[model samples]
Target chain A: MAFAVHRPESMEAVIAALDGTASVAVSGGTLAIRAINEGKSFPLAIVSLRRAGLAGIAQDDGMIEIGAATPIAELVRPDLAFLDGVIASFGAPAVRNMATLGGNLFAPQPYGDFGVALLALDASLAIAGPSGKRRLPLSKFYETGLASNEIVTGIRFAPPAPGTWRWLKATRRALNSAAVIAVAAIIETDRSGTISAVRIALGGVDSHPVRSPVAEAGLLGQVLDSASATKAGEAAATFHPCFTDTYASAWYRRRVLPVFMRRALLGTPLETMP
Target chain B: MKSSYVSFTLNGEEKELLIEPGRRLVDVLREQCGATGTKNGCGQGSCGACTVHIDGVAMLSCLLPAELVDGSEIVTIEGVVRNRVLHVLQEAFLAQAATQCGFCTAGMIMAAKALLDCDPSPSRQAVIEALSGNVCRCTGYEPIIAAVLAAAATLAKRPAAAAAA
Candidate 1:
């Protein structure tokens, strides 16, 4: 149960430390520490990402680049105001200070709202492993999982135009609770208020953050409204085979998905919607 | 596994120890340094009882590896007192009757202290967000939230009074 922790200070050092060894990389240590205490099947060696030169935010051209190890607290800045509500909806201030964007991608379902947001943003991840460095779409990373020694180095995404990104995390409690149904979408409406392009991503409904192609397909050319939002939500829920746990049940999630989808698009509460 | 020498500033004092690799910061603070002011309600990070400040940010000490914090400055509940006087947040907690069972008081005070240190005037919603990770089984969160807001008001007027005896 005891493992030696290795703190590598540079990208090269971190990449070299992952030499096909049985080690787990820890950033923030919020999730890993819990796993360790619970006596679950975990790695014998921990490579601390604390000193791994993977913390900061920068913008190049239209792309916003975030270091994988940057704490969630750092991301809640005024410049990135769209994410303020989402990040604030996560764990309390203490947990946010200790949780990292990279760790959220690896956190289990119902726990990674940031991942859902990134998927909605069409973010790309820069990964390093034994072979070399490669960039892949965030969704691809979800499907392929990680190579044995690979570590997610950073994420890059072109910022969506204003009024395009929408996120809502439905939690039983306003804070510290897992998502009942977390939804994020990037939708562009024409001057006539018809949907031009739409990408919808969801959390807490699947094993990993996922895109709701069915929902996107349902709303592409329609004028977004309560009715269209309801239909799109239904399409998305049909694709989500929700699982029941202590937080909520599958039936409860299915009942609320339509309401949340309407809220995400129409910006109206379920009760207010016609 | 070999024990490693971990060094960090604890409650403004430099500390070094040959500690087990899996040792958590909360255990080290309570067991080794006898700083029991930081209670452990739930060994998991869900309960804010093990909250502390690392490099000036409030974090769950239970989830931090003692080795990872080497050379970092840490502040626990014990560090909130200065010059034999309670921190303003603590004073406000007492004034607002925020303690019932007292198990979660230390962590709540530490969490509120961290919030006030960063934002002198946190809104009601902000206070709720800051202390959301901490759970109080008794005397629900309204009093605690009120206490934090009051402390912010007092600290804003006499900023240095918190450390004065």
Candidate 2:
């Protein structure tokens, strides 16, 4: 048996117990529990956020608020219909069923697909720790490793009205593939279908999920033409590449950056897809 | 470590047991609860052999702490049947010849049941998405897909029947 302690119930209890001693905060356990069972350790006490009511989605004032414990599987349910493509790109059905938005943030892997999507949208994380509530940029949560002391309660974001989102993950196979580089972008197209504002976020390419401001700046106000798409792709790939257990080397990622960039900028929507 | 007390509803029955905190839901079901229909394979979370429905959602029993189930409702393969008759899904599985080796049959049934319970009428894409996490080495997937589709058709017809009645 794995050595552990578990509480199914509350987030406050989970947070209170997280003294960074024996207890660890868990959300769905897709990444934390797996790592702990495999002998990875940041804490001995395992406080589950399963019963924390963190598994809900609601939109208020144009901001989509996802409960920390909300499973990625639940993200596609009509409430989160706008980000359908983003959630489906997380992993296999099982992984998505277990992986939570909180866990993905807590997981701290640079290749985390969910992280890529959220960063592009400028998501804000709601965290609870010994000191109490703190709201920060979603990217600020990582600090070289998992923050056992802090428990992430949820994330909130206000997406652009009538916008376009595109998500692409580079992988060798369907399930459990290491993300070489996962990309997510939101763009507003003008009446003539030219680009107005473009935001691009990339993961598995850096130590943390980051927005390519340079890419966004370069593409903003630019006509949404094939040449402009090519320029955005090149700008997005300007960051040095990183690798994990998945497909594509640094060179390969750089080579494929333009393909995803083009699709993210100019791709058409499919009536039915995964 | 010594065991503690836990109380949860398993397949419509409220039960309590004294178990080790380290014990997973699969261990509690198979050993403490004496429901061997919940098999244990790859005690890790990767394999679907220990899959179960907690609060109507499919999760890995092996990774779930036994104590977390306290107050939650659970369903197992043994409970898949209804009124002394096999569930439509089980019947469809047999009719479509979906099981081979049979080790993974129970977990697959549980996984499929969770999907059907939520959405009786599902698209082929939805069915495929639900079972993509389940792995079966013996029987090719075409048959299982057939079984799920058959079950979906059967399940989809019931609401109309109820409405008409």
Candidate 3:
């Protein structure tokens, strides 16, 4: 089937293009185009964000704002070194060049590892629709996906404190493989090294990435160590359901969830882990 | 659906073509432009056999719509050669026997070329990381990694030769 591609230059035009038609936004084309090549049914139209004025990174008042269409490759700058490991855990360099931050937020499980990290960081999304622009928390946006006429304009989040951010993705291959189980966490501690605040997000364990509130609650008032991490891991894995895919089995993922959660919380080196 | 016109620089040459709706860049390059060097292995983003440079950044051509390259600079395996001379990376690949079946050679070279263009002397780990997307089932990847490292070393010693290529 022939489908029209609309390369709109502005956010207003993009929303207008999606106002009524069954159109999908194309950012980097990593996901949308792949679906097309796989012989899946194409949308009525494609709204290309390549030329839209929505690709950039800006820092203001300790918050980092990244345009929704910005390539994942651009996130590897030295100034954003804290995200180095998280971004690297994504696809290889070529794929990274074509994947966008906003697209990752919508990617299915075992693929949206970056989105999991953002969830742990409490990131918010800037969405623009026909009505106007609106701010929504990333977690909430995941629950209620984009309206037909809305497009994600940008993502904003404050930088995590040094030595507090941790991310890990367990893959069958060291590179280019989908995650067997992915974990991202932000653990803040008091001056005495007692846990103050914590947010943990897990991917490859559900249909979408989910926060481990039980894990976070268990870690509070406790020191971050192997024992506490183990407890937190157990708490997080208690009743969660994991799905199986070509990369791993549901049984295997359930068995490894707690182990990976502990490893992620303890900041264990990937090379040293199973 | 109506056909659309796309104009872009292909390997230093300006070309324009009327592409059908929903056509991808890889198909256009191989069929319309006669640049068959960019192989369409999987026709999906999973395989890097269709890797090409758009605006000096490496990307999978199969995933890029023809309209997206309307005003961009594109470089394929056919463009890697300058004045009938193979690029240093090509030479190193030949010297190191990086190609067995040779199907993935073009994409591998293109991906490696972009890595070297950005970093003149990339470490072994970085070379492996850069070429990770381009899969080589026949050679087992060690020789390809060696060729890239060797090319980086050669490029480091002779800056003039590297620049000329």
Best by TM-score: 3
Residues B23-59 of candidate 3: C-alpha lDDT, one tens digit per residue: 8999999999999999998876776999999999999
Record all residue pairs in model 3 with backbone atoms less than 3 Å apart, i.e. clashing: none
lDDT of 1 by residue, B44-118 (tens): 689999888888888888887788889999988889788778888888899999999899998998888887777
Off by over 4 Å in 2: A1-12, A77-79, A108-111, A143-148, A173-178, A191-194, A269-274, B156-165
Provide DockQ values for all models, in the order shown. 0.77, 0.44, 0.79
Q: Least lDDT summed over 10 consecutive residues: which range in candidate 3 chain A?
A: A232-241
User: Per-residue alpha-carbon lDDT of model 1 for A1-274, expressed as tens digits?
Assistant: 4567788998778877767667778898888878887877477788889997899999988789999999998997866888986887788787888899988899898888889999999999989877889999999999998887888989999888998888887889867788999999999999999999999999878888999999999999999888998999998888889778888998888889988888987766547655
Candidate ranking (lDDT, best to worst): 3, 1, 2
Off by over 4 Å in 3: A270-274
Candidate 1 TM-score on chain B: 0.94
lDDT of each: 0.86, 0.74, 0.89
**Model 2 residue B116 CA deviation in Å:** 1.8
| Model 3, residue B110: C-alpha shift (Å) | 0.5
TM-scores for all candidates: the values are 0.96, 0.88, 0.97
* TM-score of model 3 (CA atoms): 0.97
- Of candidate 1 chain A, the 10-residue stretch with the lowest lDDT total is A265-274
List of clashing residue pairs for candidate 1: none
Winner on lDDT between 1 and 2 is 1
Evaluate residue B43 in candidate 3 and report its C-alpha lDDT on the 0 to 100 scale: 73
